[model samples]
Target chain A: MEIELNDSKHTRNSWMERFETYLPEVVYGSIDGIVTTFAVVAGAAGAELQINIILILGMANLFADGLSMSIGSYLSNKSERDNYQKHLHIEEWEIENMPDDERKEIEMIYRQKGFEGKELEMVVNRITSNKKVWLDTMMKDELGLSEQKKSPLKAGLSTLVAFITAGAIPLAAYILAYAGKYQIDPFILSSLVTVFAFILIGYIKTYVTQIGLLRSILETLLLGAAAAMAAYFLGDYLEKLLV
Target chain B: MEIELNDSKHTRNSWMERFETYLPEVVYGSIDGIVTTFAVVAGAAGAELQINIILILGMANLFADGLSMSIGSYLSNKSERDNYQKHLHIEEWEIENMPDDERKEIEMIYRQKGFEGKELEMVVNRITSNKKVWLDTMMKDELGLSEQKKSPLKAGLSTLVAFITAGAIPLAAYILAYAGKYQIDPFILSSLVTVFAFILIGYIKTYVTQIGLLRSILETLLLGAAAAMAAYFLGDYLEKLLV
Candidate 1:
């Protein structure tokens, strides 16, 4: 039987389809943003700092931490892609230079799966005939590296955007208070808004984690509360000491 | 051909072998512990708090955060295991109660795998004849879940042990200063030690991450510094505002 190997069509995507690709980056960024930003707010509030100082510090941390995280994300993903490409190049060179050894390796892999005798020879012949398929098999089975599908630059951008967006939630109440738009205490209002954001992010996270909605929400709330409480009490203790 | 489905023997283990099993948990806990404890140390030091107070808060956070993390780790693992078992049961029920549908699924699955005619029927028969094999294949291919290998209790315990052990590194200098054993500034010493710990943890992380040692070390250092700096400066600004 003749074997057929065709490259998959890379279809042009609608805008919504493209957005789905970065949903994970967005969720991750939002989660980190909310947790860190709220921690800053909590710490400042615990220290009884002025509202303006709190807002200033929150804004500063929002951008600084967001940039730092995005840079880290970009570098890590880029490094992974580079590493995979390096391995791919080496495997391709080996296949070209050492066909017999490469064919034996494929035989060994299929033999382990119970293909044997004439069937094994036929399977090997079919795979080796297709250069693209041979390369893919070698990449996956030999190197244990799959293709990196994500765009590092886009991942970084998504992270920065999500961080700033979700991170703004914690500071919103403080900003409103500073602008003389709301009468409620900014700290209390910030806490409420942060909790709301936590629940919202937790709902989004369920899409990724596949955990129960309530459980995910509770987990997010617990994590945020723990980080914020730690920072808050540390700031409070330090203030007491300085006084 | 005779099919073999013997269960692998559970061997008696050396303590070292057991420790290896929890290595990931240990690394994760250690990284988290060091980052958080040092953040406390950095924030307290930035606010110019008394050294004793810094140590007190650092130690408190060391255990508290460790416990929190371990609990989170335990619950998450337990939930995952429970979820798996729940699905497993559902699959089991379907296979027993509606064998026709399950067998059709098996046929469709193999047909998609390019198996055809007699071979397709043979593949389905081979899988469905043994209930255990059928269940395993369904669990893997249909649900896209593998067996949970790590024990929740052991994972949690590992996290706690690793957290306290590695987390102590940041506070060592503070303890020494509190005991009047060191004349150098405790905060300065703590910073140095924390950096050292970051390097060490990064090296250990290379085992799990398979990233280059230098890159892992740099990543760890960058992450720790970013968090500590944020906390430290936030404390400093808050102190300034209160004063």
Candidate 2:
């Protein structure tokens, strides 16, 4: 049992931790990428545009939206870490410059946590004896912050990779139609593959959400279909009206 | 200080808690709503469709997407709460049916927390003495779950309201042009107002993210513009290709 536990721990430390950290970004990018790119394809198809036009519009939307999303992700993550670091520095400065006040604040916090008299003093002494532990306690108990930092660049890269990978699925048929000798109706083929992409995304989401497979797939499919339908009908109506 | 604290506490109990609880849903709905509805408007305008067509398409996309988002939010929230509750019930059953094993588990948990011998036994006894507290401790410490439950219906309603309110901003100018004797081009007016809407969302986001006002606004504007530009250019290219 001990050996098995250690083996699992070793595996988790190596790869599982990284996977868990960036799973949210991957899910976000994948869903957004597939939905928006397919919406472009649907709209072009509804306007009775050629397969080449669908490929052009779909690819453009995929890369542009992916880049925009990644940049947004990078900026937000960087700013959040900066804010946390700023607070951390302020706390460290307070600890060094005004040790007496910092000690009092620690006592006050533990007192509120139900320790009192000698017990409170002992707890405070135990924590404040080590500068690192003191700083960590203040950061968590007083400011309610955690030090689980992540890299902004890696976050952005994960988003871009996930977006491009999932977003490209919708355009597979259109690209094939433009490139290969296969005579399948590109729009129909695109719709079919897009459905498969939605299912894949939905299955991945189940890992985080703990929802039933059928329910997640149903919700994703319905949402994607609605977006595509709206775009398609709008395009068709506009084409009839003006073209 | 006493009076100020009491007054603030009173205010928080009445409304602040609710605001904090549903703020995430509001932000989600508001951002998605504005970005998507404006994309529809941009696409229609790029196709040189009339104001009525733009209005029709924009409104349709707004309501349809809003409904889909709210429904998605509702199901996910409901499923998460359900999963938590299921685990809670299982924990309760184990405590009732196998108290010795549960007690041993509690001791193991506290012992791992640095308590030893008598101290560990005391801590475990203190926790498992009260059924509710014991259950809560097991839920939090053992299973790493929190009982911060939320009503799924209220969450869905909040999402729907935010989506409609924020999403309607981009269509405001178009609606005015259709009803009033306005001389301004509706598309230009829409572009202007949508920028304002983006700024508003960005400003609200700063309250949660603690990022600088300028940076948040710039990020939101860039993302919105990118989506709108992609939609518009795609529509324009398709129109030229087919028409």
Candidate 3:
């Protein structure tokens, strides 16, 4: 294989790599976001809010959470890349000035791997003679610096977009699908569909996380249950006291 | 100053580097997990659940979410290390068998970097003289493999155990502190405290995310509001309807 790492090449494929890195999160995140959003809308509708109010809650969640996820992903990646570059610059400068000391380090490395006598010396001499080859080797083997840098733009765009799109599906299901089904209170049907979405979202987590399919599905279902149970009991007690 | 890039003598403090690497996430994840748990407990209490029940919900959330986060971090890192190892094995075999091809690849690499004539040939001859040196050069420069593989068990355990610990804080606060208030009316005080934690978590997102802090805080707060509001309403209706 070719010697010397190409930083620029890595930069070129960064967007593609970032997309690949984020692929798993997108599907799983969408399911989670959608389920959570549905829970909010359904809960509101159950509490007897207007249809418009339920929709407003869904929209607000979509926008707000999307923005937060986007920004968080962006900043974390940027800082990590910044840290990498800072170290790289120093490593580059070291190669330019201290060739002798650097060569000694190479000789020792070969020594550790069972090289000895003139063979070790010759190997170190050859590698150290070339500055570019030496520095690239140190960066890769010693520093563990890889070509992967998380892209802020890709992260921000993907997460925000995913959240919005996923969040919308449940809202749409509640409005178009649920409202059509109920001959009585249109909103009641909406609640059922919304709760159903939570279970589905929880189930999706198993695939993304390799969490047992049964456990993931059940755990997510419990989140919904806990939410509903907490709300209902509090509402029941508060209704008694407030009235 | 070392002119050689393969220098192994790094003067930088290892402890400092490690501390910097992990400290921020530790603080962020711990505080954030606890705060989130607090909010859930508070909202549950506000819905007027008994103190014991509110405590149960908060405890459940803390353990569940914390475990989930820890497991995710472990698996993802392990997969990355595994993938890197696979690439490294291929490079190792290539170095062992195809000296001529590997030498050509090295020459091709430096040629692209603007080496030519006698100087280029000298550099290639010097690097390829020892196969180990050649292999080292190729692995570092071309393949981008690092020697450090953070133990999967350690990372996983740290995240999972830390999350669970952090998650416990809010539950403790609800059970011991808030539950004692209002003659042990566990729900309202717990929810109010939870909203406070949510507000705090939102505010931290600014620092955590490196974005418009106000927007981040606002978004998180909205999520808290919607979750609590939905729980109250949906729980109310579901309880009545189920009966």
**TM-score, prediction 3:** 0.56
Each prediction's DockQ? 0.13, 0.20, 0.10
Candidate lDDT scores, in order, read 0.73, 0.73, 0.55
* Candidate 1 positional error at B230, Å: 6.5
Rank all candidate structures by their lDDT, best first, as comma-separated numbers: 1, 2, 3
What CAPRI grade goes to candidate 2?
A: incorrect
Model 2 earns a TM-score of 0.73
Native-referenced Cα lDDT, model 3: 0.55
Where does model 1 exceed 4 Å of error? A1-29, A36-164, A174-183, A223-243, B1-18, B36-79, B97-101, B111-113, B153-157, B160-168, B171-187, B225-243
lDDT of 3 by residue, B107-180 (tens): 87666555677656766776677655676567655665444346665665666565566556556555565435
Query: What local lDDT score does residue A82 receive in model 3, on the 0 to 100 scale?
Result: 60
Model 3 off-target regions past 4 Å?
A1-69, A88-142, A146-149, A163-243, B1-32, B35-57, B96-99, B112-136, B181-243
In terms of TM-score, which candidate is strongest?
A: 2
Better of 2 and 3 by TM-score: 2
lDDT of 2 at B100: 94
Model 1: how far residue A29 lies from native, Å: 4.7
**Model 2, runs deviating above 4 Å:** A1-13, A39-68, A75-149, A174-187, A226-243, B1-11, B39-68, B86-121, B135-144, B171-187, B226-243
What digit string (tens of lDDT, one per residue) describes model 1 on residues B15-49? 76677668878877887778767777776676676
Docking class of 1: incorrect
